[model samples]
Structure formats: structure tokens, C-alpha cells
Target: MASSPLGHPTRGTTGTNRLRRNDRWIAASAAFRTAADPLVIDLGFGASGVTAFELATRLTKVRADAEVIGFELDPARVATAQAQLDDVRAGRTNFSPDLRVSFAHGGFEVPLPAGRRPAAIRAMNVLRQYDEADVPDAWASMAARLSPGGMLFEGTCDEIGRIASWVDVSSAGEPERFTLSLRLAELERPGIIAERLPKALIHRNVPGERIHDLLTALDREWERAAPLSTFGATQRFLAAVTALKRLGWPVIGGRSRWRLGELTVPWDSVAPR
Candidate 1:
């Protein structure tokens, strides 16, 4: 018999645009944009394949050759997604029938046919159910399956996609950057993302940890930028993130990205301990 999938099952809860924020990030990433193969993987795609469809839709806007494959250890979930794919192929859904997407039965191993390697892997909200210590192995197993110059985008997000954070790990299975993305509408403190951190850093949110310090400083800057709230939450967030840069935080990206409520920093800035 074939070996079983390498990871556990997720809650199987998902929606049409639950991962739209992450989809945008991947679409803009260098890995997906420059991949010769341009094949992407959606690990632990949960109950619906809609996120994969949305991902393919968004990515194709930038690279028409982009393709997406959704993976799940639960054979039932794979079947469910396949059914959705059927509808799309039949032009019964909002997605294009020509969109390149598929669903497969697999887990962290991220099996691909013809010995193909993926350009990027998006594992949103999949690791939250796993123990914090299990992260390295999972990251390694999945990252190793990536093509050179490719990355593994793994992280967690809330049900409505309002709050989220993820890590960009290289093919070597080492994290390169950490990012926090929020909706920024009627927003509260940026620290609200503390509840949705990736498995590697969720428990590290206590004092003395770099992740903890980052959230504290994030909230402090947001409060100081309160006066900008009159202009708009986006402006307020931009001011807060700019302040982070001024304070010598290794903040990445620019005004264009900050305007979208995303704050990216070097992984060392908030790595555990």
C-alpha cells in the first residue's frame, strides 16, 4: 500500500475569499512570478477548493501560465474539491473553465506527478492545529519539494480573512521573512494578529520574546498615529508602519504594500527568543 499523508487534517472550514489577502501576496512574490514551471501548491486546502480557484485566478492575471494544485490528506475533502473543480470545468461556477487548477490527495509531502517541483506552496491556516514544535519538520518536508528560488508561504489567518500572518521560507526550509496582514477597516491594535500567528511563533508571544516585542511596538506606533485615523485607517496603518521603520525595525516593503495593511519584516526581527 502507498504511504499515508504526512500531516493531520485541518478543520476543513473555508470560504470563497477567506484567503484572498494571501493570494495577493503570492501573486506578487518573486517565486511565483519568475518560476520557470510556474506551478503552485495549496496544501491542506480544507473543505472547499474555492481558495485554490481564487489563487489561480489572481495569479493568472500576472502570469497566464500559472497553475495551482490543492492538496489534502483527507480523501473526502479531495473528492469534495474535485467536485467543485468539475463545476468550474463545466462553466457552472464563477471561475473560468480554462483556469489551470486541480485537487490531489496528499499532505506535507506535497506529491506531484512527473517529478515536477512547485514554484511556491501556500499553507495558510494549516499549521495552527499542529503543535508548535512540529513546525520545523513540516516546513522542511514541504520546503524541500520547492524548486530553486521558490518559497513556501505558510501561516495562519482568521475565518473572514481580516487578520493574518505568515512566514516566507526558502527552499532550504529556513524562514526568510515574517509578515502580518490585516483588513484595516474599523481596525483596532495591530497586536490583534497575536491570536493568529503561525505555529512557530504563537506561543512565543510572551514577554522577552522578539515576537512579543514586535507586537508591543506595533501597538505603540498605532496609538501614536491615532491622529491620522481622521484621514483613514489605511493612512493610520501606513503611519504606524513608517514609524516602525524609523524606530530601526527591519521593516520590508514600501508605501504601496503598507497601504494594503501588510507589514513585512526580516525573520530575525521576530524569530522566537
Candidate 2:
């Protein structure tokens, strides 16, 4: 594959099932279910290929023809992923023998075979290391590589994957929604995601910003929902998110997703102001 025109070195830090939440969200998205092409790109999959494998495994349930390509700027990481692929091929893991996954060296400038473009791109934690000003250009580059109606999922998560947030961008590079997923049982407050916000909103979490106001309001609602804690953290979170919607926070989704500690909002509701 040709080298990406612009990219960054790999931090190479990742763990098994680190992206499970993100994977679930992608599986539920229209982009994955309706893609004319079932090809997906796992951009910047770190030191190991387990996440890529997990992504492929999860997505295939929705579209049996699903395929995943793990891209890393580090050749060594690519080699490691290749070795993992070999293990899967040899029946060393529980992954389906027909699992369609591959590894390649690439970056924001997704490099695919001639005339090929992906149906979706999951770029988790890839942009955290770059300057905020670079996010637009990086997003533009990747979005440009998507097939019609394709999507880009980009965001960050805590080390063990308990707390996560992502932005869903359309093929036009315009963000459509922002989603925050937390482990309700372990959550202390909704504001905890402030630390893990995607690059675009991390610094903007300070007062006066839309994201800041949103999180602050969410924390307040979470506090007010403490009475529901007798039921469970899940119930408490559901109540909090329900209150958020009632208060006109533009919350999306319903109890089904809130039960999983996920909250989605229109991009304009939390866009950096």
C-alpha cells in the first residue's frame, strides 16, 4: 500500500475488548447495516490486532459479508496484527474461520486498492495526539475516502474501555452526532467523560463552551436522579438522561440505549462553540 500523505506515529497502546462499546454503536448504525459495500476500516488499531478482530466479529453479525482492514502507521504494529491474523487463520482463536480482516500500513489518508473506498471508518483514539486545528483536515481526508453514504466514527476511550465517547461524521465530513458511553455501575457522575472527550471537544470542556454546558447540566441531572440509585446505576442513569431530554438537551435514543449507559445528542447540541 502507498504511504499515507499525512499521519502520525503509533502510540501502540491498546487492550482486548477496548473498543467493545464503539463496536456495538457501529453495528447499530445505518452506515454498517445499509452499506452497499461491507468493507470497514479500523484506523490506527494499536500494538495488537485484537480490537480489529473484535470489530470484524461484531460487525459480521449484522452483515455476514462484513470485512475489516486494520491500518497502522507503524510497520511493526502491522506485522503484529498480521501475526494475529495468522493465528486466527490457523484456528488458534474462537474467531470465525471465515472472518474477513486484514492489516495494512496507512493513516488518515486511507490507502485502499485502486478505485476502492470503504463503507465506514472507525478511527478511535487516532486524533488525540494531534493539534486540534489538524482535526478538520484529517477528518476531511478520511471522509473523502468513504463510499457514498459512508460514515466515520472517531473518538477516545479510557484505558480499560469503561468510559468512551465518539463523533459520528457523515461522508461529507459533517458531524451528525456525539455519543458518550459509560459503564453505569462504575460511573460517579456523567461529567467524568470530560476527560475522555474527543479531541474536538476535550479542551472545549471549559466553561462557556457548548460541550461544557452540556456536561455540567448532565452532572446536575445525574445528581438529581440519585433517588433512583436504589434501583441501580442503570436506572439512575436512565432517569438522568430522561431528565436531560425533558429539559430539552436534545438527547437522542431511548431507554434501550440509556440502559447501556449511552447518551447520544445532535452535533449542534454539543458542538464546540
Candidate 3:
């Protein structure tokens, strides 16, 4: 396998089900469902391999032959993940004996076996450490390794998975949409997602930016829908998103996803100015 160019070191902080929201989205994506190869890269899967293992388990439900490779730049972290893989292999974990998962030392370059390109690369919290200017190059590098019609889910989430957001990028490194997922019960305000925006938009949350306007409008509608709170947070969020759509904000997804506390919009609607 080819070696990746060195990139930033992550805090390596991860937890059980920390990326569960992301995994759910991936599992439901067309990239995962239609892939003939069904190979996925868990790029920079923190200090543990549980996320990779979980990814494999979830994807296999969609495609029985799904495969997952956890890539990390830190050799020590790769070794630690291997040890966890051993546990899965030894029947000491919840993973099936037939699980197809591995760990390797790599970075944003996404080193993979020759003649292989992944259908999806989930790089959760990987770029949070880099300067915002470095994101394009990092995105280009990873996007270069995707198969045709492949996708990149890149973003960040909190420690407990209560709040999460991601950008859906195509194989050409073009961002398609942005999505914010939250645990409605824990949500205080829709604007709070500004703190976890993808690197490309995180610093663009200031006034005058498109993202700023979007979030500002979201908060306004959310407050305006406060009467729906008597029904539940989910109803309030659904109402808020509907209000956004009515205001011509280019919101994507339907009440089905909104009821689950998710809101998606075209990338152009919030692209950094």
C-alpha cells in the first residue's frame, strides 16, 4: 500500500457510539447502497477502532460484503486499533466473526491497496485540528481516492453525540449539502451548530456570511415556533425548518428527517463568502 503524506495529529478522543449519527447517515446514503465494491474508509478513526467496527457492522446490513478499513497517521493508534480488531476476531466483542475490517497507518491521502477506491470516506472530526485554509487540500487529497459516484462525509460532533454536523462532498471534492443532526431533547438553540460547523464554514459564522444569515434566520424561526414546544422539541424543530423553507432558504430533506432533529440545505445556501 502507498504511504500517506503527514497531516495533523488528532486528540484521538473517541467514545462508543460517538459517531453513531454519522454512521446512520452513511448507512442510508446512496453511495453506500449502490456501491458495487462496498468498500469504506474510516479515515482517522481516533484512538480506538470501535467506530470502524461499528461502521462495518452497520454497512454489512446494507451490503453483506461490506468492508471497512480504519486509517490513521499514528502507527501507535493503528496498533491499538489492531488489538481491538483482535478482540473482535476472538469473539470477545459484539462484532460478528465474519466482520471485514482492518487498520492501517495513513492520513488524508487515504492510502489504499492498488486498484481499489472506496465508495465512502467518513472523516469525522479529522480536519478540526487543521487551519481552515488547509481544508481544501485535505479534501482534494481524500476525494482523489474515491470511486466514481463516491462520497465524503466530513465534519465534527460532540463527545456524547448529542450535536453533529457534516458536509456531503462528491468524488470531485465538490460539496453538495450540509446537514445538522441533534438530539432534540438536548437542543437549546438551532444556532448552537455554528460552533461545530465544518471547517470551511466554521470561521464564516460571522455576520455578513451566508452561513451566518442562515443560522441567524434559523434561530429567529426557532424562537418564533416556541408555542409548538408545548407539543415537543421535534415538533418545534419541524415547524422551524418548515418556516425556513417557506422563507426560501433552500432547505432540503422532509419532515421525516426533521422529526429526527436533522436539517439539510443546499451547500450554496451556506457556502462561505
Model 3: per-residue lDDT, tens digit, 1-273? 334445888897989999988998999899989998899999999999999999999989888999999999889999999998888899998789679999998888787767799999999999998899998888888888999999999999988888899999999999999999988995789898888888889999998999899989999999999999999899999999999999998888788889888899989998888
In the range 148-214, model 2's lDDT, one tens digit per residue, is: 8999999999999999999999999999999999999967998999999999999999888999999
lDDT of each: 0.94, 0.91, 0.90
Which order, best to worst by lDDT?
Answer: 1, 2, 3
Worst 10 residues of 2 by lDDT: 1-10
Q: Name the regions of candidate 3 deviating beyond 4 angstroms.
A: 1-4
How should the candidates be ordered by TM-score, best one leading? 1, 2, 3
Question: Model 1 over residues 89-156: C-alpha lDDT tens digits?
Answer: 99999899999999999999888877899999999999998998899999999998999999999999
Clashing residue pairs found in predicted model 1: none
Model 1 off-target regions past 4 Å?
A: none
**Top of the candidates by TM-score:** 1
Residue 24 alpha-carbon offset, candidate 1, angstroms: 0.4
Inter-residue clash pairs, candidate 2: none
* Candidate that would win on lDDT: 1
Each prediction's TM-score against the native? Answer: 0.98, 0.97, 0.97
